[model samples]
Target: MLDKTLRNFDIPAFQQDLINWYQANKRDLPWRRTQDPYKIWVSEIMLQQTKVDTVVPYFQQFIEKYPTPYALAEADEQDVLKSWEGLGYYSRARNLQTAVREVVADYGGKVPDSPAALGSLKGVGPYTKGAILSIAYDQPQPAVDGNVMRVFARVLNIDEDIAKPSTKKLFEKIAAELISTADPSSFNQGVMELGALVCTPKTPSCMLCPVQEHCRAFADGLEQELPVKTKGKKQKTTTYAALLIKNEQNQYMIEKRAENGLLANLWQFPMAPIDEIGMEHITNWFFAEYGVQMNIGDKAGTLKHVFSHLIWQLEIFHAMTMQTETADERIIFVKPEDLRLYPFPVSHQKMLKYILD
Candidate 1:
C-alpha cells in the first residue's frame, strides 16, 4: 500500500499548488526579468552549484560586459576567464564559450528554440537542455536538477538514492507527467523555488509550504530522510610550496597553466609540490625549474582551497629575483597593478590580496 501510494499522488493539486504559489511568490531574480535564451542560458550556467545571492552581481557584471554570444565569442579567452575568475569550475566558462561560438557559427547568433538543436551544444546536458527548453521556450519538458529532485523525493515520498544516475530518469519522467502544459516555465521554476525555500534539505518549513497538503513525507514525518543520498568519495589533499617571486621592477613572476586539465589556461604564481617550505628548498626549486636563482625571504602565508574532489594546501613565501630572464614561454612577469588582467585561481588571488593589501 505504501509503495503504490508513492506513485499515486494527486497530480492536479500538486501542479496547481506549486504553480499558484510560484506565480505569487517567486523571487525577482534578474534572470526572471528577461525571456532571452542567451541571458537565461548564462544565468542557468552561472547558477550551477552556486548560490543565487553570490551569482547576482557576477551575472550582472558578466552580462553588462558581454551582452551577446558574438561579443563573448569574439573576446579573448583570457578575458572570459578573468570575468569568471572566482566563480570556480573554470571548465564551465570554457564550455559555454565553445557552445556560444557554435551558436554564432551555426545558429545565426540565436539560441535554438528546439530541444534537439539546443541539446547539441557543447556544455548543455540533459538537465540544462530541459531547463533552457522549458524556461526559455515554454516547452513542457522537465528540468530535474538537484533542487527539483529534492522537492520530488519528499512530495512523492520516494526513498531512492538521488546520487545515482538511474534515479534521475525516474524523477524526470514523473516531472514530465506532472508538468502543467499551460505553463511549464512557472511549474519548473516553482518546484526549484519550493525546494530552495520551503522544502529545504535540513529543516523544511512544512507548515508554510503551499504543497504541504500534497507532501507524503510531511504526513509521514520523514521529509528530511526521503531524499537518500550516499556520501561521495572523500576529497584528496595535496600540499604545495608556492613562490611569490617579485623582481626589482615591481614585476611579479606569474605562469600560465597548461591548456588542458584542471583550472586549464589560467595564470598562477610559481608552485612546486613539496612537504617543506624552507629557504634552501625554495632556492633549489627556483634554479631547477626556471634556472634563475633567487633570494628567498620570510614565509608570506598559508592558504587552503577546496575544489570538487581536491584540496590545495599552499605555503606561500616571498622570493626576489634580480635576474628575470627565463627561457620558458609559459612564464611572464607582470606588475602587481596588472594582475587583474590575468586570471588566477581563487587561492592565488587570496595570497596576492594578502600581500598587496
Candidate 2:
C-alpha cells in the first residue's frame, strides 16, 4: 500500500534540508562549475548511459575540440564520431551534432532556454529538455531521469513500476511540484545527487539521507523495495566472424559501416554473422566485398561484447593479403600506427589488441 496524496508534511523544511545537504556534500563535478548552456548541454548529452568518471575525459576533449554550437555544427560528422569513439550509443553523438546544427542555424547558435524550443531539437527528450531548462536557466521544470525517479519513489514510498511511462510522468509531476522556485538548479540537481549518493539503488544509506525524516519509505522501513522496476528482456546472442586481414606491409583492412543503423559510419574490421556463412564462404565473401584476395590463417581468439538489446559473440581470425589497397570505396588499408585515428567499436578494438598484443 502506497500513499499517492501529498500529506501534511514540512515540504519547505525538507527542501531546505536537502538543498543544504547538497551544498555541503555534492561531488565536485566539472559540469557543476558552470551555468553556460552549451557546456551544460554537452555534459548532459555525454552523461547519457555513461558513468561520470568515464564521461569526464571525453567531455573535456569534446569541449576543447568543439567549444560552441557553431564549432560542433561546422565539424565533420566522422570527426565528431571520432571524438565520441569510446562512449557507446554513438547515435547520441550523431543526434547531438544534428541538434547543435539546428541550434546554430535556427536559434542563432544559442541553446534554447524554454522547454518547448529545446524539446523540438533532435534527440532532446523530456529529461534532456528539463535538465537544460532547469539547470541552465533555473526554470521550474522537472528532470525525472532514473536517479530522480528512484529518489521520489523512496521518499513517497511509491510501489508502482518505475519502468512504466505513466509512472515516470507521475514522478515528473511530483518533481515539478517539489522544485524550489528560488533555486531550481540546486533543487533538481540535489534530488539526483541524493539518489546517486545516499539513496543508491542498492544499500541506500537512509540513516545518512538528509530527507530521511520526511521520507515515507524510511518511516515505513520500505526504502529498499519502494522503487520497483520490471526486469528488461534478455539480450539475444548473435555469432560473428571478425576478419583481421593484414597486408605484407602490415596495413590492416577496415570498412565503414552503412550510413544508418548500429555503429553507423564507424570503422570496423570486416565481420559477418556466422549463421549460414562458413569459413570458405567468408573468405570468398571477403574477396567479393573488398576485391582483395586473402589467405586465411589460424583462429586468433573469441570475444563477447554486449549491447543493450543484443550480445555479440565474435570469433577472431587472422588473414594475410598481398594487395595494399582496396578497390571498394568503403574499404581502406591503413597502417597499424594509423588505426588509432579511426573510431572503432569496443568489440573491434579488443580484436585489434588480440592481434597486436
Candidate 3:
C-alpha cells in the first residue's frame, strides 16, 4: 500500500500547495528579504540546532557588526567569539569565521554558489549548501534539515530512523524529486515552515496543514508514530574545582582554555578536575598546574552546567596564590569591571557572578 501510494504521489500538486501556503504564510525573517548569499549563509549556520526566536537578535547584531564577508574575515577572532558568547556552540562561530576568511581571500569576497565550492568552506555542509544555492541562486537543491526530515517522515509514512545517515540520504533524494523546479526556494522553505508550525513533533495541526490531504501518515492514522528516531547516549558528568583568586591590585586571575580542546580560547578562572570535593586537593592541583601555591578560603558557591554530551559539577572556592603572581602567558589578571571584555563560557560566566556578588 505504501509503495502504491508513493508511486501515485502527485508531486506537482503537493509542491504547489506547499509553496502557495508558504508564500502567504511564511514568517518575515531578516534573511528572507535579501538575495545576498553571505547573509543567507550566516542565517543558515546560526539556525542550526538553535531556535528561531533565540537566533533573531543574535543574527541582527552579528550582521550589523560584520556587514560583509570581508568585515567578518578581517575582524579579530576574540571579538567574534565574544559576539557569540551566550550562543553555546563556540565551534560554530570559529568555523564560520574561518569559512568567511576563505571566501574573502579565495572566492573574491563572494560566497560561492556551486556545491563543490561552497561545501569546501570550513563550515558549509550539504544542508547549508542546498539552502544557499536554492535561496540565493534559485537552484533546485534540497536542504534536508531536521524540520524537512520530520515533515517528510509523515508525508511518505517513512518509519526509518531519522537519526541515521541513510534516512537523511533517502530524504535528500525524495526532496530532490519533489522540489518545485520553478520555485525551489519557496518549496524548500515551505516544507520547513510546515514542519516548524503546523506539522510539529507533538500534536501536529493536521487540519491546518496545507498538504494534509496528501500526508501518508495522516491517511494511515500514524501521524504521531511515523518518524522513528533512536535515542542518543546519556550525558556523562565530570567534577571540577574552580578557583576565584583576587590579588592586591583588585584584579581577578583568569586563564584562557587550551587552543584545541572544548571551549578552546575562551576565558575562565583557574580550574582543575577533582575526584571529590576537597579544598586541600583543589589547591594542590592548582599549585601543580601553575607552579604557585594558593590558599583556599571559604566556599564561594557551586554550579552545575549541562552540555550536549557532558555535565559539569563545579565547586567554586575563594583562592589566593602564595606568590601573588601567575607567570604563564595564558593566565591574565583583569579588574572586576574588565572581566566582561573577555568571552567566557556560560559555566564560567555563572562563576564570575557568584564570586563577584
RMSD of each: 2.1, 1.9, 1.8
Q: Which pairs clash in the backbone of model 3?
A: none
Best by TM-score: 3
Report how far residue 350 has shifted in candidate 1, in Å.
Answer: 1.0
Assess each prediction's global lDDT (C-alpha) against the native. Answer: 0.88, 0.88, 0.88
Worst 10 residues of 2 by lDDT: 1-10
When sorted by TM-score, best at the front, the candidate numbers are: 3, 2, 1
TM-score winner, 1 or 3? 3
Off by over 4 Å in 2: 1-4
Residue-wise C-alpha lDDT for candidate 2, range 183-203, written one tens digit per residue = 888898899899888999998
- Candidate 2, 80: how far from true, in Å? 1.5
Q: Which parts of model 3 are misplaced by more than 4 Å? A: 1-5, 276-279, 322-324
Q: Residue 116 lDDT in model 2?
A: 81
